[model samples]
Target: METNEILRNQIFEIIKNQLKHNNPPETKITLDRLRAQGFNDSQARQMIGQCISVEIYQIMKTNEPYNNARYIENLQKLPKEPFE
Candidate 1:
């Protein structure tokens, strides 16, 4: 994969790991957190998508039901991938 894809995937994994054994948060809440941490809107969106990927992986790995609202919200923020 390309560097961008790698970065996106890496970010996704981080989110997945971070959310492991936890409840999904609101999309706006996640975005707000990212922005508070100094990420721009674009970056915030990317991070959200990463979080969604993480959530999905977590659900599959643990066979537990994940939050659908947050996942949908994050999915809305995801770009086409292969960031520029």
Candidate 2:
């Protein structure tokens, strides 16, 4: 459990850093990048999902005049595994 938590944190940090460096903060992260970072397929997928969830949360917090419809729409735009 401890190891899993540590790995998850590392994956999250990598994804976050990549996003931060992008000119427009890409909506999708490639599996190739995650694999190059040493994550297996399942781990990569989990990390991508976590990244999307975090982005959704950030959007919810930062966007003004929050609209439920827009929030859901934005979430639907987030990258999904196997396709990203």
Q: Which candidate's TM-score is highest?
A: 1
Error of 2 at 5 (Å): 18
* Model 1 misplacement above 4 A: 1-25, 67-84
lDDT per residue (tens digit) for residues 1-84 in model 1: 899789777766655554563444455566567677788977876657665666767788879888676565554554423221
Candidate 2's TM-score = 0.36
* Each model's Cα RMSD: 11.1, 11.9
Give the range where candidate 1 is weakest over 10 consecutive residues by summed lDDT: 75-84
TM-score per prediction, in order, is: 0.41, 0.36
Model 2: CA > 4 A from native: 1-29, 64-84
Would you list the clashing residue pairs of candidate 2? none
RMSD in angstroms, candidate 1?
11.1
Error of 2 at 10 (Å): 23
* Residue range 36-56, candidate 2, lDDT tens digits: 668786776565656545545
